[model samples]
Target: MTLDALKIPETPVCAAALEVAVAYCSPALLNHSVRAYIWAAAYGEAQGIAFDPELLYVGSMFHDIALMPEFDNHTAGFDVASGHVAWVFGAGAGWPVTRRRRLVEVVISHMLDSVDVAADPEGHLLERSTSMDISGRHMDDFSAPFKAEVLRRYPRLGIAEEFLACFRDQAVRKPDSSPAASLRDNIAERILANQLDRTG
Candidate 1:
Protein backbone atom coordinates (compact mmCIF):
# COMPACT_ATOMS: atom_id res chain seq x y z
CA MET A 1 0.00 0.00 0.00
CA THR A 2 1.09 3.57 -0.67
CA LEU A 3 2.09 5.84 2.22
CA ASP A 4 -0.95 7.98 1.56
CA ALA A 5 -3.25 5.09 2.34
CA LEU A 6 -1.86 4.37 5.76
CA LYS A 7 -3.81 5.78 8.70
CA ILE A 8 -0.80 7.48 10.23
CA PRO A 9 -1.69 9.23 13.46
CA GLU A 10 -2.07 12.95 12.95
CA THR A 11 -1.11 14.10 16.40
CA PRO A 12 1.32 16.97 16.85
CA VAL A 13 3.69 14.88 18.92
CA CYS A 14 3.81 12.26 16.21
CA ALA A 15 4.54 14.88 13.58
CA ALA A 16 7.13 16.49 15.80
CA ALA A 17 8.77 13.14 16.40
CA LEU A 18 8.97 12.51 12.67
CA GLU A 19 10.19 16.02 11.99
CA VAL A 20 13.10 15.70 14.39
CA ALA A 21 14.13 12.35 12.94
CA VAL A 22 13.85 13.54 9.35
CA ALA A 23 15.81 16.69 10.11
CA TYR A 24 18.84 14.63 11.01
CA CYS A 25 18.57 12.24 8.03
CA SER A 26 19.36 12.81 4.39
CA PRO A 27 16.43 13.39 2.11
CA ALA A 28 16.92 10.11 0.29
CA LEU A 29 17.10 8.06 3.47
CA LEU A 30 14.07 9.85 4.80
CA ASN A 31 12.05 8.96 1.73
CA HIS A 32 13.20 5.35 1.78
CA SER A 33 12.34 5.02 5.46
CA VAL A 34 8.85 6.31 4.79
CA ARG A 35 8.44 3.80 1.99
CA ALA A 36 9.63 0.98 4.22
CA TYR A 37 7.26 2.02 7.01
CA ILE A 38 4.30 2.05 4.67
CA TRP A 39 5.20 -1.40 3.37
CA ALA A 40 5.62 -2.80 6.90
CA ALA A 41 2.40 -1.27 8.20
CA ALA A 42 0.41 -2.65 5.27
CA TYR A 43 1.85 -6.09 5.82
CA GLY A 44 0.93 -5.93 9.48
CA GLU A 45 -2.65 -5.00 8.66
CA ALA A 46 -2.90 -7.85 6.19
CA GLN A 47 -1.75 -10.36 8.77
CA GLY A 48 -4.28 -9.07 11.33
CA ILE A 49 -1.55 -7.78 13.58
CA ALA A 50 -2.11 -4.84 15.88
CA PHE A 51 0.39 -2.26 14.73
CA ASP A 52 0.33 1.36 15.82
CA PRO A 53 0.65 3.08 12.48
CA GLU A 54 1.87 6.26 14.10
CA LEU A 55 4.48 4.49 16.16
CA LEU A 56 5.59 2.57 13.12
CA TYR A 57 5.81 5.76 11.15
CA VAL A 58 7.75 7.48 13.90
CA GLY A 59 10.03 4.49 14.42
CA SER A 60 10.77 4.16 10.72
CA MET A 61 11.36 7.87 10.31
CA PHE A 62 13.91 8.04 13.07
CA HIS A 63 15.46 4.63 12.45
CA ASP A 64 18.52 6.09 10.78
CA ILE A 65 19.03 9.65 12.03
CA ALA A 66 22.35 9.05 13.77
CA LEU A 67 24.85 9.85 11.03
CA MET A 68 27.95 11.18 12.69
CA PRO A 69 30.89 11.38 10.27
CA GLU A 70 33.45 9.73 12.54
CA PHE A 71 31.44 6.71 13.67
CA ASP A 72 29.94 5.90 10.28
CA ASN A 73 33.06 5.79 8.09
CA HIS A 74 32.58 2.38 6.47
CA THR A 75 29.11 1.59 7.65
CA ALA A 76 26.00 2.27 5.61
CA GLY A 77 24.56 5.74 6.21
CA PHE A 78 21.51 4.09 7.73
CA ASP A 79 23.68 2.68 10.51
CA VAL A 80 24.89 6.13 11.40
CA ALA A 81 21.35 7.37 11.30
CA SER A 82 20.28 4.73 13.81
CA GLY A 83 22.20 6.27 16.69
CA HIS A 84 20.69 9.72 16.33
CA VAL A 85 17.22 8.27 15.95
CA ALA A 86 17.49 6.56 19.29
CA TRP A 87 18.90 9.58 21.05
CA VAL A 88 16.55 12.18 19.70
CA PHE A 89 13.18 10.50 19.43
CA GLY A 90 13.62 8.04 22.24
CA ALA A 91 14.59 10.74 24.68
CA GLY A 92 12.14 13.31 23.42
CA ALA A 93 9.01 11.20 23.07
CA GLY A 94 8.57 10.62 26.79
CA TRP A 95 7.04 7.34 25.76
CA PRO A 96 6.92 4.55 28.26
CA VAL A 97 10.55 3.78 28.90
CA THR A 98 10.06 0.26 27.58
CA ARG A 99 8.36 1.47 24.45
CA ARG A 100 11.09 4.03 23.82
CA ARG A 101 13.73 1.38 24.27
CA ARG A 102 12.00 -1.02 21.91
CA LEU A 103 11.62 1.71 19.30
CA VAL A 104 15.34 2.30 19.32
CA GLU A 105 16.08 -1.41 19.08
CA VAL A 106 13.73 -1.76 16.15
CA VAL A 107 15.40 1.12 14.39
CA ILE A 108 18.96 -0.07 14.93
CA SER A 109 18.48 -3.77 14.23
CA HIS A 110 15.76 -3.76 11.61
CA MET A 111 18.10 -3.56 8.66
CA LEU A 112 21.33 -5.00 10.05
CA ASP A 113 20.06 -7.98 12.04
CA SER A 114 17.39 -8.95 9.56
CA VAL A 115 17.61 -9.36 5.74
CA ASP A 116 20.89 -10.42 4.17
CA VAL A 117 21.16 -8.79 0.79
CA ALA A 118 24.95 -9.16 0.54
CA ALA A 119 24.74 -12.64 -0.97
CA ASP A 120 22.49 -11.67 -3.83
CA PRO A 121 24.35 -10.02 -6.72
CA GLU A 122 21.16 -8.48 -7.98
CA GLY A 123 19.90 -5.97 -5.44
CA HIS A 124 16.18 -6.11 -6.15
CA LEU A 125 15.21 -9.76 -5.87
CA LEU A 126 12.88 -10.01 -2.87
CA GLU A 127 13.75 -13.06 -0.77
CA ARG A 128 10.96 -13.42 1.72
CA SER A 129 12.20 -16.50 3.59
CA THR A 130 15.62 -15.15 4.48
CA SER A 131 14.04 -11.90 5.51
CA MET A 132 11.46 -13.65 7.71
CA ASP A 133 14.13 -15.80 9.34
CA ILE A 134 16.23 -12.79 10.10
CA SER A 135 13.27 -10.95 11.56
CA GLY A 136 12.29 -13.91 13.75
CA ARG A 137 15.85 -14.46 14.88
CA HIS A 138 16.27 -10.81 15.73
CA MET A 139 13.30 -10.95 18.05
CA ASP A 140 14.37 -14.29 19.53
CA ASP A 141 18.08 -13.59 19.84
CA PHE A 142 18.05 -9.94 20.80
CA SER A 143 19.20 -10.76 24.29
CA ALA A 144 21.98 -13.09 23.15
CA PRO A 145 25.49 -12.54 24.51
CA PHE A 146 26.68 -10.78 21.36
CA LYS A 147 24.04 -8.10 21.75
CA ALA A 148 24.61 -7.68 25.45
CA GLU A 149 26.44 -4.44 24.92
CA VAL A 150 23.47 -2.89 23.23
CA LEU A 151 21.06 -4.40 25.70
CA ARG A 152 23.08 -2.97 28.56
CA ARG A 153 23.07 0.44 27.00
CA TYR A 154 19.38 0.42 26.18
CA PRO A 155 18.25 -1.68 29.15
CA ARG A 156 14.48 -1.44 28.90
CA LEU A 157 13.72 -2.60 25.37
CA GLY A 158 12.50 -5.82 23.75
CA ILE A 159 11.15 -6.63 20.31
CA ALA A 160 7.85 -8.42 19.88
CA GLU A 161 7.42 -11.14 17.25
CA GLU A 162 4.59 -9.35 15.52
CA PHE A 163 6.57 -6.12 15.30
CA LEU A 164 9.56 -8.05 14.04
CA ALA A 165 7.38 -9.66 11.38
CA CYS A 166 6.36 -6.24 10.07
CA PHE A 167 9.92 -5.03 9.96
CA ARG A 168 11.09 -8.27 8.33
CA ASP A 169 8.56 -8.11 5.51
CA GLN A 170 9.57 -4.54 4.78
CA ALA A 171 13.25 -5.44 4.64
CA VAL A 172 12.59 -8.52 2.52
CA ARG A 173 10.62 -6.52 0.03
CA LYS A 174 12.93 -3.49 -0.08
CA PRO A 175 14.39 -2.80 -3.50
CA ASP A 176 17.76 -4.49 -3.90
CA SER A 177 19.59 -1.18 -3.85
CA SER A 178 21.06 -0.30 -0.48
CA PRO A 179 18.97 2.27 1.37
CA ALA A 180 21.51 4.98 0.51
CA ALA A 181 21.65 4.02 -3.14
CA SER A 182 17.89 3.76 -3.47
CA LEU A 183 17.42 7.18 -1.91
CA ARG A 184 19.96 8.68 -4.29
CA ASP A 185 18.23 7.22 -7.32
CA ASN A 186 14.86 8.29 -6.03
CA ILE A 187 16.08 11.85 -5.59
CA ALA A 188 17.63 11.98 -9.04
CA GLU A 189 14.46 10.61 -10.54
CA ARG A 190 12.34 13.17 -8.75
CA ILE A 191 14.58 16.00 -9.92
CA LEU A 192 14.53 14.77 -13.50
CA ALA A 193 10.81 14.22 -13.40
CA ASN A 194 10.30 17.73 -12.13
CA GLN A 195 12.57 19.22 -14.78
CA LEU A 196 10.75 17.29 -17.47
CA ASP A 197 7.42 18.50 -16.22
CA ARG A 198 8.53 22.11 -16.49
CA THR A 199 9.99 21.61 -19.98
CA GLY A 200 7.11 19.54 -21.29
Candidate 2:
Protein backbone atom coordinates (compact mmCIF):
# COMPACT_ATOMS: atom_id res chain seq x y z
CA MET A 1 0.00 0.00 0.00
CA THR A 2 1.12 3.53 -0.64
CA LEU A 3 1.23 6.35 1.92
CA ASP A 4 -1.85 8.00 0.43
CA ALA A 5 -3.91 5.00 1.42
CA LEU A 6 -2.61 5.02 4.97
CA LYS A 7 -4.13 7.08 7.75
CA ILE A 8 -1.35 9.14 9.29
CA PRO A 9 -2.31 11.07 12.41
CA GLU A 10 -2.23 14.79 11.74
CA THR A 11 -3.50 16.42 14.87
CA PRO A 12 -1.93 19.60 16.24
CA VAL A 13 -0.10 17.70 18.95
CA CYS A 14 1.17 15.12 16.48
CA ALA A 15 2.48 17.90 14.28
CA ALA A 16 4.20 19.50 17.25
CA ALA A 17 5.86 16.23 18.21
CA LEU A 18 7.12 15.78 14.63
CA GLU A 19 8.51 19.31 14.72
CA VAL A 20 10.39 18.56 17.91
CA ALA A 21 11.81 15.33 16.56
CA VAL A 22 12.93 16.92 13.30
CA ALA A 23 14.47 19.87 15.14
CA TYR A 24 16.45 17.75 17.55
CA CYS A 25 17.18 14.35 16.03
CA SER A 26 19.64 13.66 13.20
CA PRO A 27 18.24 13.01 9.72
CA ALA A 28 18.61 9.27 10.15
CA LEU A 29 17.00 9.34 13.57
CA LEU A 30 14.11 11.49 12.40
CA ASN A 31 13.34 9.14 9.53
CA HIS A 32 13.57 6.19 11.86
CA SER A 33 11.03 7.76 14.21
CA VAL A 34 8.54 8.43 11.43
CA ARG A 35 9.02 4.96 9.98
CA ALA A 36 8.35 3.43 13.40
CA TYR A 37 4.98 5.15 13.58
CA ILE A 38 4.10 4.16 10.02
CA TRP A 39 4.91 0.52 10.68
CA ALA A 40 2.92 0.45 13.92
CA ALA A 41 -0.13 2.19 12.52
CA ALA A 42 -0.13 0.10 9.38
CA TYR A 43 0.27 -3.11 11.32
CA GLY A 44 -2.46 -2.13 13.73
CA GLU A 45 -4.81 -1.51 10.82
CA ALA A 46 -3.93 -4.79 9.13
CA GLN A 47 -4.49 -6.69 12.39
CA GLY A 48 -7.66 -4.79 13.23
CA ILE A 49 -6.17 -3.64 16.52
CA ALA A 50 -7.68 -0.47 17.93
CA PHE A 51 -5.13 2.16 18.87
CA ASP A 52 -4.97 5.88 19.60
CA PRO A 53 -3.18 7.34 16.61
CA GLU A 54 -2.25 10.65 18.20
CA LEU A 55 -0.82 8.98 21.28
CA LEU A 56 1.17 6.47 19.27
CA TYR A 57 2.52 9.14 16.97
CA VAL A 58 3.59 11.33 19.85
CA GLY A 59 5.19 8.41 21.69
CA SER A 60 7.04 7.23 18.58
CA MET A 61 8.40 10.72 17.88
CA PHE A 62 9.76 11.24 21.39
CA HIS A 63 10.82 7.66 22.09
CA ASP A 64 14.40 8.29 20.96
CA ILE A 65 14.80 11.94 21.91
CA ALA A 66 16.77 11.12 25.03
CA LEU A 67 19.44 9.52 22.88
CA MET A 68 20.39 13.03 21.78
CA PRO A 69 22.69 14.94 24.08
CA GLU A 70 20.23 17.79 24.54
CA PHE A 71 17.72 15.47 26.17
CA ASP A 72 19.94 12.61 27.31
CA ASN A 73 19.84 11.71 30.99
CA HIS A 74 23.10 10.46 32.51
CA THR A 75 21.35 8.52 35.26
CA ALA A 76 18.03 7.34 33.85
CA GLY A 77 17.73 4.97 30.95
CA PHE A 78 16.99 6.71 27.66
CA ASP A 79 13.53 5.18 27.67
CA VAL A 80 12.85 6.57 31.14
CA ALA A 81 14.15 10.00 30.24
CA SER A 82 12.17 9.95 26.97
CA GLY A 83 9.02 9.06 28.89
CA HIS A 84 9.52 12.09 31.14
CA VAL A 85 9.96 14.30 28.09
CA ALA A 86 6.82 12.87 26.51
CA TRP A 87 4.93 13.49 29.75
CA VAL A 88 5.94 17.12 29.75
CA PHE A 89 5.02 17.42 26.08
CA GLY A 90 1.64 15.91 26.82
CA ALA A 91 1.02 18.42 29.58
CA GLY A 92 2.01 21.27 27.28
CA ALA A 93 -0.39 19.89 24.68
CA GLY A 94 -3.19 20.19 27.29
CA TRP A 95 -3.70 16.48 27.65
CA PRO A 96 -5.32 15.40 30.91
CA VAL A 97 -3.18 13.87 33.66
CA THR A 98 -4.31 10.33 32.89
CA ARG A 99 -3.59 10.80 29.19
CA ARG A 100 -0.13 12.15 29.93
CA ARG A 101 0.54 9.16 32.15
CA ARG A 102 -0.59 6.87 29.36
CA LEU A 103 1.86 8.56 27.02
CA VAL A 104 4.66 7.87 29.47
CA GLU A 105 3.59 4.26 29.72
CA VAL A 106 3.68 3.91 25.92
CA VAL A 107 7.13 5.48 25.68
CA ILE A 108 8.64 3.27 28.36
CA SER A 109 6.92 0.06 27.28
CA HIS A 110 8.47 0.31 23.80
CA MET A 111 11.70 -0.88 25.40
CA LEU A 112 10.09 -3.96 26.91
CA ASP A 113 10.31 -7.47 25.50
CA SER A 114 6.56 -7.43 25.10
CA VAL A 115 3.44 -5.43 25.84
CA ASP A 116 0.06 -7.11 26.04
CA VAL A 117 -2.17 -5.50 23.43
CA ALA A 118 -5.20 -6.11 25.63
CA ALA A 119 -3.61 -4.07 28.37
CA ASP A 120 -2.10 -1.26 26.24
CA PRO A 121 -2.57 -1.31 22.52
CA GLU A 122 -0.43 1.75 21.86
CA GLY A 123 2.44 0.40 23.93
CA HIS A 124 2.26 -3.02 22.31
CA LEU A 125 2.22 -1.50 18.83
CA LEU A 126 5.13 0.79 19.57
CA GLU A 127 7.19 -2.03 21.05
CA ARG A 128 6.57 -4.30 18.10
CA SER A 129 7.11 -1.55 15.55
CA THR A 130 10.35 -0.30 17.12
CA SER A 131 11.62 -3.85 17.34
CA MET A 132 10.82 -4.37 13.68
CA ASP A 133 12.61 -1.16 12.72
CA ILE A 134 15.67 -1.73 14.89
CA SER A 135 16.14 -5.47 14.63
CA GLY A 136 13.93 -6.54 11.70
CA ARG A 137 11.70 -8.50 14.03
CA HIS A 138 8.27 -9.48 12.65
CA MET A 139 9.15 -8.14 9.23
CA ASP A 140 7.25 -10.91 7.53
CA ASP A 141 4.04 -9.55 9.00
CA PHE A 142 3.97 -6.68 6.52
CA SER A 143 3.54 -6.89 2.78
CA ALA A 144 6.53 -6.05 0.60
CA PRO A 145 4.73 -3.20 -1.17
CA PHE A 146 3.81 -1.61 2.12
CA LYS A 147 7.36 -1.89 3.35
CA ALA A 148 8.66 -0.36 0.14
CA GLU A 149 6.31 2.58 0.43
CA VAL A 150 7.41 3.26 4.00
CA LEU A 151 11.04 3.20 2.99
CA ARG A 152 10.40 5.44 0.03
CA ARG A 153 8.88 8.09 2.25
CA TYR A 154 11.26 7.72 5.17
CA PRO A 155 14.53 6.35 3.89
CA ARG A 156 16.92 4.81 6.35
CA LEU A 157 20.05 6.99 6.41
CA GLY A 158 22.54 4.62 8.01
CA ILE A 159 20.52 4.63 11.21
CA ALA A 160 21.94 1.25 12.19
CA GLU A 161 25.43 2.61 12.84
CA GLU A 162 24.21 5.85 14.39
CA PHE A 163 21.74 4.18 16.72
CA LEU A 164 24.29 1.57 17.78
CA ALA A 165 26.76 4.28 18.69
CA CYS A 166 24.12 6.06 20.74
CA PHE A 167 23.21 2.86 22.55
CA ARG A 168 26.87 2.05 23.16
CA ASP A 169 27.37 5.44 24.76
CA GLN A 170 24.27 4.93 26.87
CA ALA A 171 25.49 1.51 27.96
CA VAL A 172 28.85 2.86 29.10
CA ARG A 173 27.26 5.70 31.08
CA LYS A 174 24.41 3.64 32.55
CA PRO A 175 25.64 0.10 32.87
CA ASP A 176 22.37 -0.91 34.51
CA SER A 177 20.24 0.62 31.76
CA SER A 178 18.15 -1.39 29.34
CA PRO A 179 20.54 -0.44 26.50
CA ALA A 180 23.37 -2.05 28.43
CA ALA A 181 21.33 -5.22 28.66
CA SER A 182 20.63 -4.98 24.93
CA LEU A 183 24.36 -4.61 24.28
CA ARG A 184 25.01 -7.76 26.28
CA ASP A 185 22.42 -9.55 24.15
CA ASN A 186 24.29 -8.71 20.93
CA ILE A 187 22.02 -5.88 19.84
CA ALA A 188 24.87 -4.73 17.57
CA GLU A 189 24.54 -7.83 15.45
CA ARG A 190 20.78 -7.52 15.45
CA ILE A 191 20.88 -3.90 14.28
CA LEU A 192 23.45 -4.65 11.64
CA ALA A 193 21.57 -7.67 10.38
CA ASN A 194 18.27 -5.89 10.04
CA GLN A 195 16.94 -6.40 6.52
CA LEU A 196 15.47 -2.91 6.49
CA ASP A 197 18.98 -1.49 6.21
CA ARG A 198 19.52 -3.45 3.01
CA THR A 199 16.07 -2.59 1.66
CA GLY A 200 16.73 1.12 2.10
Candidate 3:
Protein backbone atom coordinates (compact mmCIF):
# COMPACT_ATOMS: atom_id res chain seq x y z
CA MET A 1 0.00 0.00 0.00
CA THR A 2 1.13 3.53 -0.68
CA LEU A 3 1.96 5.88 2.16
CA ASP A 4 -1.09 7.96 1.21
CA ALA A 5 -3.30 4.94 1.72
CA LEU A 6 -2.16 4.58 5.33
CA LYS A 7 -4.34 5.98 8.10
CA ILE A 8 -1.58 7.86 9.88
CA PRO A 9 -2.09 11.19 11.60
CA GLU A 10 -1.44 13.64 8.79
CA THR A 11 0.05 16.43 10.77
CA PRO A 12 2.97 18.52 9.60
CA VAL A 13 5.08 17.15 12.42
CA CYS A 14 4.41 13.57 11.37
CA ALA A 15 5.23 14.37 7.78
CA ALA A 16 8.51 16.00 8.78
CA ALA A 17 9.43 13.03 10.91
CA LEU A 18 8.85 10.69 8.00
CA GLU A 19 10.97 12.92 5.82
CA VAL A 20 13.83 12.81 8.27
CA ALA A 21 13.69 9.03 8.36
CA VAL A 22 13.62 8.68 4.60
CA ALA A 23 16.53 11.10 4.35
CA TYR A 24 18.69 9.03 6.65
CA CYS A 25 18.07 5.79 4.79
CA SER A 26 19.57 4.59 1.51
CA PRO A 27 17.34 4.15 -1.53
CA ALA A 28 17.77 0.38 -1.58
CA LEU A 29 17.16 0.20 2.14
CA LEU A 30 14.18 2.49 1.68
CA ASN A 31 12.82 0.00 -0.82
CA HIS A 32 13.15 -2.66 1.82
CA SER A 33 11.25 -0.35 4.13
CA VAL A 34 8.38 -0.26 1.65
CA ARG A 35 8.23 -4.02 1.50
CA ALA A 36 8.71 -4.41 5.22
CA TYR A 37 6.04 -1.87 5.99
CA ILE A 38 3.63 -3.62 3.66
CA TRP A 39 4.33 -6.97 5.27
CA ALA A 40 4.15 -5.65 8.80
CA ALA A 41 0.95 -3.73 8.17
CA ALA A 42 -0.69 -6.66 6.42
CA TYR A 43 0.38 -9.07 9.12
CA GLY A 44 -0.88 -6.80 11.85
CA GLU A 45 -4.17 -6.28 10.02
CA ALA A 46 -4.60 -9.99 9.35
CA GLN A 47 -4.09 -10.67 13.05
CA GLY A 48 -6.47 -7.91 14.19
CA ILE A 49 -3.73 -5.84 15.74
CA ALA A 50 -3.94 -2.06 15.93
CA PHE A 51 -0.70 -0.65 14.55
CA ASP A 52 0.04 2.76 13.10
CA PRO A 53 1.11 2.13 9.54
CA GLU A 54 3.04 5.38 9.49
CA LEU A 55 4.83 4.30 12.63
CA LEU A 56 5.60 0.92 11.14
CA TYR A 57 6.63 2.55 7.88
CA VAL A 58 8.85 5.31 9.19
CA GLY A 59 10.15 3.22 12.05
CA SER A 60 11.12 0.37 9.77
CA MET A 61 12.56 2.66 7.11
CA PHE A 62 15.08 4.08 9.49
CA HIS A 63 15.44 1.07 11.78
CA ASP A 64 18.91 0.35 10.38
CA ILE A 65 20.00 3.91 9.68
CA ALA A 66 22.46 3.82 12.55
CA LEU A 67 24.51 1.07 10.96
CA MET A 68 28.22 1.75 10.64
CA PRO A 69 30.38 0.13 8.01
CA GLU A 70 32.23 -1.84 10.68
CA PHE A 71 28.97 -3.47 11.66
CA ASP A 72 27.70 -4.63 8.32
CA ASN A 73 25.63 -7.21 10.12
CA HIS A 74 21.90 -6.76 9.47
CA THR A 75 20.77 -7.96 12.89
CA ALA A 76 23.19 -5.81 14.85
CA GLY A 77 22.45 -2.75 12.75
CA PHE A 78 18.70 -3.21 13.08
CA ASP A 79 18.90 -3.60 16.84
CA VAL A 80 20.79 -0.35 17.32
CA ALA A 81 19.03 1.69 14.69
CA SER A 82 15.52 0.64 15.62
CA GLY A 83 15.94 2.34 18.97
CA HIS A 84 17.33 5.50 17.42
CA VAL A 85 14.60 5.70 14.82
CA ALA A 86 11.94 5.31 17.46
CA TRP A 87 13.42 8.07 19.56
CA VAL A 88 13.94 10.48 16.73
CA PHE A 89 10.62 9.85 15.11
CA GLY A 90 8.66 9.96 18.32
CA ALA A 91 10.24 13.22 19.35
CA GLY A 92 9.78 14.76 15.95
CA ALA A 93 6.14 13.84 15.85
CA GLY A 94 5.56 15.40 19.25
CA TRP A 95 3.84 12.28 20.43
CA PRO A 96 2.74 12.10 24.05
CA VAL A 97 5.78 11.29 26.16
CA THR A 98 4.33 8.02 27.37
CA ARG A 99 3.24 6.99 23.91
CA ARG A 100 6.59 8.01 22.50
CA ARG A 101 8.34 5.88 25.06
CA ARG A 102 6.13 2.94 24.24
CA LEU A 103 6.80 3.45 20.54
CA VAL A 104 10.52 3.50 21.24
CA GLU A 105 10.22 0.33 23.22
CA VAL A 106 8.39 -1.35 20.41
CA VAL A 107 10.95 -0.27 17.83
CA ILE A 108 13.88 -1.27 20.04
CA SER A 109 12.25 -4.56 20.78
CA HIS A 110 11.07 -5.29 17.23
CA MET A 111 14.23 -6.97 15.95
CA LEU A 112 13.93 -10.21 17.87
CA ASP A 113 16.79 -12.39 16.67
CA SER A 114 19.18 -9.45 16.62
CA VAL A 115 19.20 -9.37 20.38
CA ASP A 116 20.14 -12.10 22.89
CA VAL A 117 18.37 -15.29 21.89
CA ALA A 118 18.99 -17.16 25.15
CA ALA A 119 17.71 -14.31 27.24
CA ASP A 120 14.97 -13.30 24.80
CA PRO A 121 13.50 -16.48 23.51
CA GLU A 122 10.31 -14.60 22.80
CA GLY A 123 12.14 -12.33 20.42
CA HIS A 124 13.67 -15.34 18.70
CA LEU A 125 10.25 -16.83 18.31
CA LEU A 126 9.01 -13.54 16.87
CA GLU A 127 11.80 -13.57 14.34
CA ARG A 128 10.86 -17.11 13.43
CA SER A 129 7.22 -16.12 13.19
CA THR A 130 8.04 -13.21 10.91
CA SER A 131 10.08 -15.51 8.73
CA MET A 132 7.26 -17.99 8.50
CA ASP A 133 4.76 -15.22 7.87
CA ILE A 134 6.81 -13.89 4.98
CA SER A 135 7.28 -17.37 3.54
CA GLY A 136 3.57 -18.17 3.91
CA ARG A 137 4.31 -21.33 5.89
CA HIS A 138 3.29 -23.03 9.11
CA MET A 139 5.73 -24.06 11.83
CA ASP A 140 4.67 -27.18 13.67
CA ASP A 141 7.40 -26.93 16.29
CA PHE A 142 6.54 -23.44 17.52
CA SER A 143 6.25 -23.29 21.28
CA ALA A 144 2.94 -22.44 22.88
CA PRO A 145 4.33 -19.29 24.45
CA PHE A 146 5.65 -18.15 21.11
CA LYS A 147 2.37 -18.72 19.38
CA ALA A 148 0.47 -17.05 22.16
CA GLU A 149 2.70 -14.00 22.15
CA VAL A 150 2.42 -13.63 18.38
CA LEU A 151 -1.34 -13.92 18.47
CA ARG A 152 -1.52 -11.53 21.37
CA ARG A 153 0.59 -8.87 19.71
CA TYR A 154 -1.03 -9.24 16.29
CA PRO A 155 -4.56 -10.34 16.81
CA ARG A 156 -5.51 -9.05 13.36
CA LEU A 157 -2.93 -11.21 11.63
CA GLY A 158 -4.66 -14.53 11.79
CA ILE A 159 -2.48 -16.37 9.34
CA ALA A 160 -0.48 -18.35 11.85
CA GLU A 161 -1.28 -21.68 10.24
CA GLU A 162 -0.39 -20.46 6.78
CA PHE A 163 2.80 -18.84 8.02
CA LEU A 164 3.78 -22.02 9.83
CA ALA A 165 3.25 -24.13 6.76
CA CYS A 166 5.34 -21.79 4.64
CA PHE A 167 8.01 -21.76 7.31
CA ARG A 168 8.22 -25.57 7.30
CA ASP A 169 8.35 -25.74 3.54
CA GLN A 170 11.15 -23.19 3.48
CA ALA A 171 13.11 -25.18 6.05
CA VAL A 172 12.67 -28.33 4.01
CA ARG A 173 13.76 -26.45 0.91
CA LYS A 174 16.92 -25.14 2.55
CA PRO A 175 17.85 -27.37 5.44
CA ASP A 176 21.56 -26.60 5.75
CA SER A 177 21.73 -22.81 5.75
CA SER A 178 21.83 -20.45 8.71
CA PRO A 179 18.49 -19.22 9.95
CA ALA A 180 19.02 -15.70 8.56
CA ALA A 181 19.75 -16.92 5.05
CA SER A 182 16.93 -19.36 5.26
CA LEU A 183 14.54 -16.58 6.20
CA ARG A 184 15.81 -14.40 3.37
CA ASP A 185 15.37 -17.15 0.84
CA ASN A 186 11.94 -17.88 2.21
CA ILE A 187 10.92 -14.23 1.69
CA ALA A 188 12.41 -14.22 -1.79
CA GLU A 189 10.60 -17.39 -2.75
CA ARG A 190 7.35 -16.07 -1.36
CA ILE A 191 7.67 -12.91 -3.40
CA LEU A 192 8.43 -14.90 -6.54
CA ALA A 193 5.60 -17.24 -5.88
CA ASN A 194 3.19 -14.38 -5.42
CA GLN A 195 4.26 -12.87 -8.72
CA LEU A 196 3.90 -16.16 -10.55
CA ASP A 197 0.50 -16.81 -9.07
CA ARG A 198 -0.68 -13.34 -9.86
CA THR A 199 0.44 -13.64 -13.46
CA GLY A 200 -0.75 -17.18 -13.97
Number of the top-ranking candidate, with lDDT as the measure = 2
TM-score of structure candidate 1: 0.48
Predictions ranked by lDDT, top down?
Answer: 2, 3, 1
Q: How well does model 1 score by local distance difference test?
A: 0.43
In the range 1-200, model 2's lDDT, one tens digit per residue, is 56778887879999999999999999999999998898899889989999999999999999999999999997999999999999999999999999999999999999999999999999999999999999889989787877887888889989999999999999999999999999999989999999987774
lDDT, candidate 2, residue 52?
Answer: 96
What are the runs in model 1 whose C-alpha is more than 4 Å off? 1-3, 68-84, 112-200
TM-scores for all candidates? 0.48, 0.98, 0.48
Q: What is the C-alpha local distance difference test score of each model?
A: 0.43, 0.93, 0.46
Model 1 C-alpha lDDT per residue in residues 53-164, reported as the tens digit of each score = 6556666666545432322324334443464555555667677777666565555555442433343211111112112222222123222332333223322122222223
CA lDDT for candidate 3: 0.46
lDDT of 3 by residue, 106-170 (tens): 45554443534354332333343344444434334333444444334334232323433433443
- How accurate locally is residue 40 in candidate 2, as Cα lDDT from 0 to 100? 91
The global Cα lDDT (0 to 1) of model 2 is: 0.93
* Residues forming the 10-long window of minimal summed lDDT in candidate 1: 121-130
lDDT of 1 at 73: 26
